[model samples]
Target chain A: MKHIESESNASLKQWKKLHSRKEREKTGTFLLEGPHLIEEAIHSGAKLQHVIVEENYQMKDEWLKERFSLWSVPAKLMKQLSETEKPQGILAVCEMMDQPEDLIKPKGRYLLIDGVQDPGNLGTIIRTADSAGLDGVFLGEGTADLYNGKTVRSTQGSLFHLPVVKADLLQIIGQCKEQDIPVLSTSLQEAVDMRRASEVEGFALIVGNEGAGVQETLQKESTMNVKIPIFGQAESLNVSVATGILLYELQRNRS
Target chain B: MKHIESESNASLKQWKKLHSRKEREKTGTFLLEGPHLIEEAIHSGAKLQHVIVEENYQMKDEWLKERFSLWSVPAKLMKQLSETEKPQGILAVCEMMDQPEDLIKPKGRYLLIDGVQDPGNLGTIIRTADSAGLDGVFLGEGTADLYNGKTVRSTQGSLFHLPVVKADLLQIIGQCKEQDIPVLSTSLQEAVDMRRASEVEGFALIVGNEGAGVQETLQKESTMNVKIPIFGQAESLNVSVATGILLYELQRNRS
Candidate 1:
């Protein structure tokens, strides 16, 4: 274990920069807080750079100590690195996950998001996608940063379970078409009843912004558009919840 | 129209008390912020006790002005009443919605929540239930206060559309049993696959705490236990998203 007491410690400065999307993207590294997420990352075989722990912290998990070195941080310094109201005493600095070559491959269920602005919503969508056994998620421009703290926390470690790659939705839809996979978009105008949607072997489901449905261009490009009927008066469902329903319905036919 | 300038005003003090659950319960009133929610409440025929706005704020909606008198407050006082980071210029203090007489009647889709601690999750569940045309939602003990700011906000005005009554789960489940309404609980312990679970016309779906599934007592009491299968590495779904999926699937059989 290495002790770091200074406020301006070099490594601390680098970790602080991980808070910014630009810094995270440029460096290809991010920070994760709490034991649950860290343990999940470990189980997923994520490449952890180092584990940072508050000074005097005891290693209850013997495997953790043997797997990675601990950089002992001052309690105050650890607080600075935390994103939650109550700072968990430990964090892991991890490299950006590499997407598998077959992430965009045909014959698998996938979630395609465009400009889903809320971090919590985006994260929940990713987690739901993982639970649905999605091959990967394609995130397009204007979407929340995959590394945003809220997004990471809301994902509940599913971030490590599946590939969430940023790409153009139109481009991804084109690829799906070429691969003989259907692309579905949610839209009020063009959408048919969700039940009427075909249960194909492979398909990509597109969910969009909280305030807006899928973009016009993307909706037009999809193989079909479906709408979850609002049987009552609420204008719409929460974006993440809507995605979950759509994903579950799509998978219901598979099994 | 009324002007409230002093922070010590009696009504303002009462409004402040609404921030607490005890006060909201005792007074039978709650605060609502933002134009969208306020407008929704107004449209839902929710009794508007008071509509407070910035002194210079103007009501362009003729129906709003004719239906309810406006109370103008200085910007600072309005800020004190606001909960969001960016508060809309208007806020409404409305009467607690009356849970309809036939809320638990035998023939409508329903949701029963047990110990769901997150206000946001509870709110989203209520919103989704409303969207699915659920008759009413029975919120049992240990669940987040429906009047909590986060809960109110997340409901997205669906709060006014449906009856969300606080009750004891066991008692409600007993009533559901008597009414011959099928009560289904989500469980990993003794659950059948959700896809195979029969969706009936009038069923009560019980969702529990984010960490703990339905209470053993409640689970054992349910007519059936169903689980959403995880086809990937993730262990569970976000509570609200799970609720959304359940509500949609259950409703799919209806309309």
Candidate 2:
């Protein structure tokens, strides 16, 4: 273990920079806050560069002490590095996960995210897609950054469990077409009721921005546009909740 | 139209106090910000006490001018009373809704929320319940205040569409039993798979805290405990999304 008391320490300065999306992308690594997310990363065999903790914090898991080098920093410095209101006294620097070499396969279920600006919604959609056993997620232009602190926290560690890729949604849709995978886009207009959507062996479900449904171009490109029926006065469901219902309906009968 | 430039105007001072939950409860009134929500309130026939707009903002809906008194306040004052980052130059002071005189009816579907602390989750759950056409929602002790700014905004005007009551979960469960409505408590322990749970003519689905889940007491009191099976590495679903899935599944067969 090494002790770093100054805020200007080189490692501390670099770790603090991870708070910015640009910095995380440029460095090819992001910070994981708190013990639970760090433990999940470890369990998922994520590539971790270092584990940092407050100088007075005790490591509860003995294996963690033996497996990784620990950097002990002052409490104030730890707080400076944490994005949350309450610092958990621990953090981990982990490599950005690699997109699966084969982004989509025949007969595989997938989620195509389009311009979901809310970090919380984006993260929950990923977590729900994971729970639904989706093969992967494709982040279209304008979606929140996958490594955003709010998003990572919202995913509740599922970010480590599945493949999430940032790519041109149009290209993905084209590829799915080639593979005979149906692309179902959610839209408020010219759409079939989601209940009537036929389940297939595989699909690429596209859900979009908070106010807008799927972007017009994507809706036009998809095999079909589907919508959850609004049975009451609510204009629409929250995007994340709608995604959850769609994924559940898509997988329910298949299982 | 009444023009008030002073921040200390009695009405302006009173409206600002609505930002606090205590003030909202004490006065039995809450503020709705933005044009969309105000219009929704007007359309829903909610008790709108007054409409306030920034001095420079022009009222587009001519009927709004004829139907209610409008107070024009300074832009800075409007920002002070507004919860969102962008104020949209308008706000409305509305009376808190009255719970339905008859709380629960025979064979009516409902949602019981327990200890969901996040205002966003609570609001989204309420919106989902409305979208699912549930008869009403009972907010158990420990759930976020319905009138909190974030919650009101997250509901996206759905707050005006349905009946939401603050009540004791145990008592609500007892009422459901009397009405022959099965009270399904969502739980992780010794719970039947949610998919296998039979669809009913009416149900009272109780979802709980994000972390601790349905309190032990409520779970024990409910008619049955149900769990959404996780098919992947994620541990659980976001409470709001889980509520959406449960509601969608509960209503899908009946619709």
Candidate 3:
């Protein structure tokens, strides 16, 4: 373990650059903050390159001291590296797992996200997918960066528990079809009531943008488009909440 | 209709002060920004005391000029009175609905919230309750203020469509018992699986703090304690998502 007291340090500069999405993508790694997330990363065998902590923060796990490159920085430096208003004094740099095209299997439950622009919403949806025991999550183009700080925080460490891949929706949809997995798309018009949608063994549920229900091309490609019934005056449900309800319904009625 | 260019003007000052919870509570009114919310406010028959817009904004609704006290302020002043990153150039001063004690009926679906601290989560829960056609939403102490901007935005104007009351959860539970309405309290321990829970005609579901499940005293007072089964590795669901799932289950199984 070493102490990093200066922001001008070369290593500190590189760590600070991880805050940018371009830098994260280039390095194939992302920074996640807080003690719980770091612990989760360690437990999940995520490739954590470095574990950084504020100088005053106590090291709870003695094993972490020797597990990876440990660096202690001043509170000012920690705050600069953190995205939240209240920094938890610890963060880790973990390699983005290499996702192969075969991450999705023939018999699996999956979530296909298209154009969810909010990082918080994307993270919550990922977390919900994990909570529903979905086999994987495929993020289409225009979705928020999965490695964004807010997305990491909102995920509550569930990102480590599931397979989340960034891929093209059309190609992924084609793959699901080839594998005989029914893809259910959520839509606001000309769709079967979600409650009455037939149950399937292997499925891919597609949820879309906040304002636009789902892209027309994607809706056309889906095996069926389903809509949750609004029993009251609310025009719509929040995207994350709606996804949760749909996932729960899918799981609840699985034959 | 009047035009005001100065932030120090009396009405503009009062509108700016509505940004704070103390001022909003004291005045029994709240400020809502954006065009959609203003339209929702008008359509819901909510008491709109004042409508303020940027000087450059075009009035699409001529009736708004005659319906309320319309004030036009310069962009700089409108920005000062707005909460969003980009002010939509229109906002309204709405009187808070006076919620009567008798809002809860003998046979009606309802949601009881306790200690949900995040304004966004609280608002989304309320919106979900509205989507589920709950008759009312009773907020217990420690919950976020319903009039908070984030909470209001999260509701997406569902706040205007339903009766939302600030009340004591224990007292509300007592009333449910007296009226023979089933009270379903969510709990993490020693609770029946919600999937197996019987359907009901009219029910009140209680969801609690983000960290803590429903309060013990309130849980003890309930007809039954129910738990959503966790099918995955997630420790728990986001409070709002969990509330949405529970409400959906309640409505889906309504006999």
TM-score of each: 0.96, 0.96, 0.97
Report the lDDT of model 1 for residue B124.
91
Query: TM-score for model 1?
Result: 0.96
lDDT of 1 by residue, A25-90 (tens): 999988899888988888888888889998877756654654666799888999999888888888
Pairs of residues clashing in candidate 3: none
CAPRI verdict on model 2? high
Question: lDDT tens digits, residues A1-255, model 2?
Answer: 899988789988998999999999999999899988988888887888989999888777654654666889888888899999999999988999877676778988899999999999999999999998889999999999999999998999999889999999999999899889999999888899887885667999999999887899999899999999888899899999999988887777754
User: What would the DockQ be for model 3?
Assistant: 0.87
Q: What digit string (tens of lDDT, one per residue) describes model 1 on residues B137-196?
A: 998899999999999999999998888999988988888888999999999876888777
True contacts kept of 1: 0.93
Per-residue lDDT of B164 in model 1 = 91
Q: What order do candidates take by lDDT, descending?
A: 2, 3, 1
lDDT per residue, candidate 3, A1-255, as tens digits?
799888799988998899999999999999989988888887787888888889878878654654678889999999988888999989888999776568668878989999999999999998999988898999999999999999998999999998899999999899899999999999888988777764677789999999986799999999999988898899899999999989988777542
Candidate 1 docks with a DockQ of: 0.88
Stretches of candidate 2 above 4 Å error?
A63-68, B63-68
Candidate 1, superposed: residue stretches over 4 Å from native: A65-67, B64-69
| lDDT agreement with native, every candidate | 0.87, 0.89, 0.88
Best-to-worst ranking by TM-score: 3, 2, 1
Q: Model 2, range B128-241, lDDT digits (tens) per residue?
A: 998999899999999999999899888988888889999988999998899999999999889987777757789999999999999999999998899887878898999999
